[model samples]
Target: MNAEIDFAPLLPLEWLAVLAAISAAAVVLSLVLRSPGWALRGLAALALLTALGNPSLTQELRDPLPDVAIVVIDESASNAIDGRDAQTEAAETELAAALDALARDPDAPMEVRTVRVDRRSESVEDADQGTRLLTALEGAAAEIAPDRIAGAILVTDGQAHDPEVFSNFPAPVHVLLTGREGEWDRRLALQTAPAFGIVGEEVDVAFRVEALGDAPEEATRFARVEVRLDGEIHTVVDAPVGRTATLPIPIEHGGSNVVSLSVAMREGELTDRNNAAVFSVNGVRDRLRVLLVSGEPHPGERTWRNLLKADPSVDLVHFTILRPPTKQDGVPVFELSLISFPTRELFMQKIDEFDLIIFDRYRRRGVLPNAYIENVARYVRDGGAILIASGPAFAGVESLYRTPLRSVLPGRPTARIFEQGYRPEVTELGERHPVTAGLVHENAVQAAPSAEDADPGEGPTWGRWFRQIELEATSGQTVMSGASAAPLLILDRVGEGRVASLASDHAWLWSRGFEGGGPQAELLRRLAHWLMKEPELEEEALTAEVAGAEVTVTRRSVETTPGRLTAASPSGETLEAEFVEVGPGRWQATIRAEEPGLWTLTDGVLEGVAAVGPPAPKEFENPVSTGAVLAALADASNGGVMRLADGMPDLRRVRPGRTAAGRGWIGMARQEAYSVRDITLTPLAPGWLMLLLAAGLALGAWRIEGR
Candidate 1:
């Protein structure tokens, strides 16, 4: 038992200083006056003041609290390589017996918590085991108090990428690593590739082969990589690595192309699971078919012409209506300088032939009747693309907004024109969006400016358009907003067709070097391609690219957030992975899916995308034959490193607080407790008797002092 005195003061130490001064003054007065009564009075006052300071005795008792032990087991991909599986089972059984014996002990004070760290096999890439350890610790710590934690025991090979996270742990961490020593191997790494490339074009893919631990110095490993197009091997190549190898694989069709690359693990290699990977690439059309119509020639007419003509692959059919359909000019049809507009031949006869139709500064003229306008709407609904670059005429009574095409256009023209020169900026959503991503003010520096006052040095910064259609955006994604969040550029789908409405026709001036041109060509290209259902423009797609035996897989989504990529082998094992962004709106990762077969890749939330291959080479088929490669992790940590040949130990139990051990089992004994109490009290005075005694003592002292 322990006890201590604690004082509770009514006043602060500063008041105590005042009391000391008063006592000193009384002493000085008594000495100067030669009064013995003054001395006695001062002594009594000091005793009374001291008694008023409250004090009490405190006692404390301690009892043993439960100690918690956390056991973490690694079940990642590398842990399952060889005989490590059996080793893991044996360790678990021994540990379980130790825990059971401790729980049964009458003096044990420890509790055991078990955690398993498994590989994210349902993904596309290798999962790091160390990350899982940190996660498990975080979870366990949250559930249990830090003060009660005794220590942590990890059963792993220690192939963790993040060991630094363990440094801040409050308890000692012990590793019982499981793996054999002398494990060495090789792996295929996909170096690089473009996420999106034009069909029929040769895209360069770079890759390499890495030899891990004691691989032969001068050994040559032959890697056979096959490029598959829609489940068929389009091309195959054999390459020797250690040096960077670039393979120019042609994209045959436009869409998601799944490519698998496989490398044969050398004979007698440790493990073969890392011998292959898969990559995906989005294929895009090489050219676009555009049909442009103008009711009357304007400055924007030349803009569309120049833009389309700039690309050699673009097929442009431009038609201008020099005269209105209602005009009764005296000039003969043969003498007219312009040919009749082929409205029927184009819209009614073969509207599906064109990928995109752009109507620039056009009105509802008699050239196209109500029936033909309805036909155009039907064409857009049937997987065609349309763009309406509206001008001032769109606000008039004859505006197409009043025609059958009005139902498909994004906004209704309010005829309000805001002429202030404002910097053209992409909306917040457009920053990461595929259509206008990376096309902000910085991209404008390269565009041709349309204003005379614009300085050549200034270039065409992101500047505002002159007019806006003060119309509500009822449907689709509003990519560009003007003053007060006014919809400027709207993209929406109408019956399988993509439609875009640009509120201002002056956008052409930005393309013509008026204020220094912006990224007009790029913006137009993305818009046109996106409307044509190009795979690269898809909001979400799973694609793969192969160069030799190294493949880089990619998953593209309209959602800016990144999602996990899961690749499944025919054996039903899945690998969860993540892709990095190599360019705007593109996420990719290089993995060697070397075994080949119909390897399936997915984000799990989306559809399962597949890559087909004949069994890569029979050499790396056995993924679990090597025991040496499986034990490297056991040697790194201060754990007993042994092999299956060494023989497994029996389980045992030990005392909890003392670390006592038994046979093959380790146990923590349970603690027991009982309680006891005692109480006592004492009185300073016995009622009236103490008062009478105090009076008699006072009288005796006074009489004696008087003499």
Candidate 2:
């Protein structure tokens, strides 16, 4: 307990000033009138004033409070280096013990508040600062006022994200580094990478390799780097250290493409975690080439051309066989405005140049010989796509199914052609296939309408078709069905390529608003892209998207149910993801994500990658425990930075105006904080005593003035 004396006014200052003025005037009048009682008059006024003022002695009982010394512990990702974490633990233990001992002393007491900050896989706000200790320090300072703050001590690997946030801190900031003095690490760094690039085009990527700390210059001057994209290793070269090297990397496909560069681990390296770096670059297509072949002019022929032509990314090559040579009577080719068919060029020479080749009601013609037909088959089996829109001609003797191409065809016509109006519906398999699933019948009057009739507004059914050639599924999945529920759309894989068969060419009637005008354009567009092997349209696939702290996982398959999937974090922890069917061939679920980095997903067999959080976050950019990031902050605060690996320094307390650090000891500025618990005011004299003294003085002055 402590004691103090203080004064509080009994009356308002304005009233007290008036009383003083009256007393001074009375004394002056006695002196000017040559009265011998001038001193007596002054004495009476003093007594009266003393009684009115009521001055009292107040005693305050105060309880001393210890000064708070905050110790912010750095547990960020960089502290995971070889011996940094262990070293930090030891230093924390020692610092706590010293502060506790100081608190036990009677002359100088201190309070310790230790704040432990866990590692950050990545932080967006800390992206530019490189470390996150300052935010935590500012928070601690706000909790304890500056008057009682002994000083702030940061125990870290020396890398701070926001050292500039120290302006708000009233106390000095000291750094206690946690790594060895001579440790070395070799790291691969990405100098520059475009966030988006055109698929199949060479993109310029720059990178560097360098030795950190005091490692031998020769050892790092030349390092071997392994470059990979989408998990496939491709580039390996010995790159010179401390310099940027520009190389060409082809963007392989559309959507997210991840590129990772890693350097082989060297002996005695501090840590291999920072030896590699990864980044994501989105892939985009430049253009798509499509070849359209129409056996004869049909209503739907223009529909197909219009869909492809509307897309700016699609380059359409359309041809119409106006008159088959077999149907030609006496017409001369030169006299007519028709040009010779380019079968040899499109089918044999430049076949691979086209992304997709569509055949509408195409049948064997004398113009395209048996060899040319065989070339088309080979093309489909060699990474090319083919779509067959079967008509009554498919049931004829000259059907393309009777040629060598039959082996690649997914179905064969059965000579049973339904010529009645029938609404189209998706098969069970189509509900899970990317191409046919999720397709809405925009114009059809019903959802599950009758094949014979469609009402004004009911089930999902496309506009009625006049004809549907019956076909038997040979190999491949049937996605759509028509009249009597027979296969209307069939998809198959032939070697490395894909093939699709549509049973009718009357789909163009939907575009004419027949019934309601169906989703003919949408269906054909997706079907074409699927045949071209778009990754998102694959029969079996897993994908993930990230938004803030939530990660959405999607799985697509032809199976009846989408089972549980497992997501792996960069830290090697696996979490089960539950998915709900959002559409045919699509299942999605969102999960809480705490760690930021590359996230991998799998259904036991196939695996995919997605990055969560900021791009190339500064926290994980470098994992070495270096003092460079925090050196400036320590200097400006007049604090010393010392490595704990050498030895733990002593903790001391000093006066407020003195320096708070020394060669072997760190000191905290004394705040001299206290709280007043009780106060008592004592009157120096009785009120009656003052009244008697004033009367005696006034009488003496009256008598002296009369004499």
Candidate 3:
């Protein structure tokens, strides 16, 4: 309990002060005149003034409130290097013990609150913000009253990304750093890279091999960097360390083209995780140039034209055979209104300019001679794409199979035709192919036990084609079957090019909405893109998808038994990914990602790469720890940064403006905080007592004057 003098004024203080002044002057005048009762008069005046002032005594029942000392611990990725983790653990224990000892003090006690900031606690969205010790410190300080805060202590590697956040903090901030001197690391840093590029075009990428801290001379001179495109080793280049170098990488195909670069690890370096970097550049086509050759004006001819024209990215060049050279109609050449077909210009001069060539119901005609037909065959052999949409003429005497182009065609006509209507079915192989995968009718979806449980024999229930040309698939996989299980669609790879054959011309019926229609447009689009060598439409593929720390590995193949896939993590540890059949010819497995970096997966035949986080994790950007990051912050708060390697500092309490840190000890301010539990006010001068005192003093003065 504490007592202090307080006031409860009965009259205005100004008026009271004036009356006191007048009484003091009269007493001084009496003293000058040698009056006998001057002292008594002064005493009476004091009593009256005290009564008017209303003096009171206040007593407070108080409870001492403990000051708060916050300790923020750093456990980020960088803190785990070079024995820093153990150092941090030891420092944390020492600080906690010291704070506990201080809490036992009877006069000045403190409550210790520990806050931990680590990479694992950070969300995927905060992955870019490295170590945020200041953020955690602010949060802990906000939990208590500002006046009750003693100080903030951070036990970390001193690589705080947000160090300047606590300039005006309420109390001193001290840092106990981990890690020793002479630490070093070599890292691969991407200075500039494109997020996307045009397919088949060369894009310039700039990067640097960085040497941090006390890296050796060998690490700072020249380094061998391995560059990989789509998980396969593309090349090895000698890069000069500490300088940016530009490399030209060609975008192979459409879709994600991941380019990964990793430098050779140096001995005694901090970590190998920062020695590698991975980035994905999306490959996009400038424009899809398609050449559509129609043998005759058929009902399905306009369907292909309309579909290709609807896409803004496709540049379609169409031609129709109206008048062949063998036609015997006698007419003047000038009088004819037909535009001559530029067969030589399209088939011979500029055949390489087109990305895909579509022969819609086309057959061997006199307009395109045997020489032009042979040129088309040569075109397919040298990294070109051709799609054959056969009509009845394909099985007749004018069949394209009879020409030199038969060498590149995947199917051969059997001189037979099925005129009956039948629904097209996707073969078992098509279920795993990216183009035909996951395409099922609504009825098929409802009929299955579940969405993933597809019936083997079930196909899409849509409009039926009235006619199909019978063919023998000689050199390709049959993806679609027609009436009576006959090959309807065949896909094949000849040398570096691709070929696709669809043995029916009634696909336009579906576009006409006949019998509720079907996925004609979708099927055509996928088939076209697949023929153009789109990477996503490959027959066999290995890929990985990452969501947080979980990685899902998917293998797509036509074979029934796909062996176990081997995955190499960024840390160079190999893990086996077992497969379970999720659908026909498709298998999947999910595993927990051990760390964040580039992950390479291979199934002997195909390889793929997946990145679990950003191209370069910020935590590993500067692996060697030092006190430079938090030095300014500590100085601003009147604290010092000390290394735990020397020894744990002694904790002490000091005044607010004094130095909070010295060579051997760190100090926290003495807050002296308290709370008033209860307050009682008692009047010091009562009115009756004041009046009696005044009358006694006045009578004394009167008696003295009479004497």
Candidate 4:
């Protein structure tokens, strides 16, 4: 409660001033003349002025408003590192207790309002956003006026994502870091990664191994650096600590290639969760070198030439045996236009230069000797690709299978040929294999083989073939079959190379639009790429993709579901992913990611990898708790930042113009805010009473003058 005196004058202040001046002049004149009646006149004038002016005493009942203080606790992903969570909880309890005591104090009162911020509330425009306490603090202070705000305090690791919110804060901001002293940490940093690179070429990756917090710079040296390409460990090197290293990575296939780099955990490290980083670089092919060899000038031979010529990436080297050694013509070689075949140049000279070699109905005619065949067989075993398009000759005596190439060939002809038209079909494995999965003939009028033409009542949309060589798969997967469900296409891997055989040479019949041409081009394209060791076409594999906090895992197989896959998080925790068959051979499942980093998935044999956030997440980039990021805000607001690990400092209330923190104490400003509840007014002196007093005083002074 408070009380004060107030006045209300009947006459204007200027008139009152004039009347007082006249009374002062009269008193001065009377003093000069030595007249006692002058005092009586002065008393009457004072009475008149007093009667015109009204005054009263007012008593007010006021309620003291508690000053508001905002306490922001950061719960971002990085804050969970080490023992920071426990540290934060302890500091919060102490601060709350201190604020409660301050509010209960008799002399001064304050209100503490706490707000917690985490990565969930952070702006997702950038996936790797750090702590966003400043923005949240602004919102928390929106309802309270500047004068009512005592101050604000933040408990975090000091990695703020938004700095603009600090420009116009209503009160001072004090930060309390939540990490212990001498915390050691080593994190991988990807300084530069390209978005695109040509296949078979080396891409440059610039990176660094940082030693942060209490870790010594010398600890960074001799640390094992692991590099993974497409989920497999490609290489390991001893990288220098605190320095940048350039890694030359070879692009494997034409697609997105994920590159993951990680540093080994150091002694007493803060956490290994942030030691790994990942990035993706798309691989594109520069050119496709294809060597197409045709034994004779057949009608379907032009089909192979046209398809290879249409693609700009394919550099086609085509040749047909215009005259075999078996030909007994009357004309001599000198008289006719005949060019010598470069068997030595093609077979042994630069065979490795070609990406693929296609054999279309070629028989031994003493042209390519046994040595040439042996060299070709050696080429396939040495990581080279080969595709055989057989004809009637494969079932006869001059079959290429009878040569040294039989070792790597997937299938052998059964000395029989189906000459009747039959619709081509994809085997169970083909439907799930990357090369044939979701394959469709765009202009095909049929969605499936005619119910009468297809077995099991369903099959792929395709054209009919006039003939196919009956064969049995010797080694490898039979991806496609022909008439009576005979093996038509077989894919195999021998040594380090790949081999595929299409039993029928009449595949060109589909290209000629026989009963509506099928996916001849697409089928041939995929087969050629699969032989070239395209990563996507693997018959059995695992792949993963990240979408925000969820990871989608896909398994491709020729057999049944490969049981349950295990995913190990960055924190070394395992999650079992139950597979659900989404297609013929593709099984998929999604798991929610709790944190951001390199996540690994494996199914006993094959492994897959995915990255949830940025290459180097901003939050993980600086895991060390420091006051630098929020120091400016604290300083500008007259507040200081301190480490919670040191000890919980005293919470004091300071004036707005004074410092808010010191060596052992952090303070909140005293707002001194209040509200008035009631007010009243009453007259002090009445007009009649003042007039009577004035009359008596005048009468007495006049009587004294006469005596």
lDDT of each: 0.64, 0.79, 0.86, 0.82
Candidate 1 lowest-lDDT run of ten: 121-130
Of models 1 and 4, which has the larger lDDT?
4
Better of 1 and 3 by lDDT: 3
* Tens-digit per-residue lDDT, 99-123, candidate 1: 6665555554567899887765212
Residue clash pairs of candidate 4:
none
Q: Report how far residue 239 has shifted in candidate 1, in Å.
A: 31
**C-alpha positional error of residue 286 in candidate 3 after TM-score superposition, expressed in Å:** 1.0
Better of 1 and 2 by lDDT: 2
Best by lDDT: 3
Higher-ranked by lDDT: 2 or 3:
3
Task: Report the C-alpha lDDT of model 3 over 92-148, residue by residue, as the tens digit.
Answer: 888889999998898998899889886662334456677888989988888899888
| Best-matching candidate per TM-score | 3
How much is 26 displaced in model 4, in angstroms?
22
444 Cα displacement, candidate 3 (Å): 9.9
Q: After superposition, how far is residue 219 of candidate 3 from its true place, in Å?
A: 4.7
TM-score of each: 0.48, 0.85, 0.87, 0.81
Where does model 4 exceed 4 Å of error? 1-64, 77-82, 106-108, 119-127, 180-187, 211-217, 220-224, 230-242, 252-256, 268-274, 328-339, 438-461, 674-707
* Cα distance off (Å), candidate 2, residue 570: 4.6
| Candidate 2 structure quality by residue, lDDT tens digits, 1-707 | 54344434467878878999998998898799878999998998888777777767777888888888899998876776787788888888888888889878786677889887765434533443455688888888788867888887888987776767765355656789887777777767678889999888978889888777778766668988888876678788888988888878889888888777777888878766556666788887788889999887877788899999999999999998877777767878776546777989988899889988998888877768888888889988888899999878998886889888898999999988899999888898987788876665444443334644744335575568889999999989999999999999999999989999999888888788777667788788889989987777888877777776577888878974666778887668878877887876688877766655566777765678776655445665556677787777666655667778778888777776566667877777777888889987787544788899999988998897788
lDDT of 3: 0.86
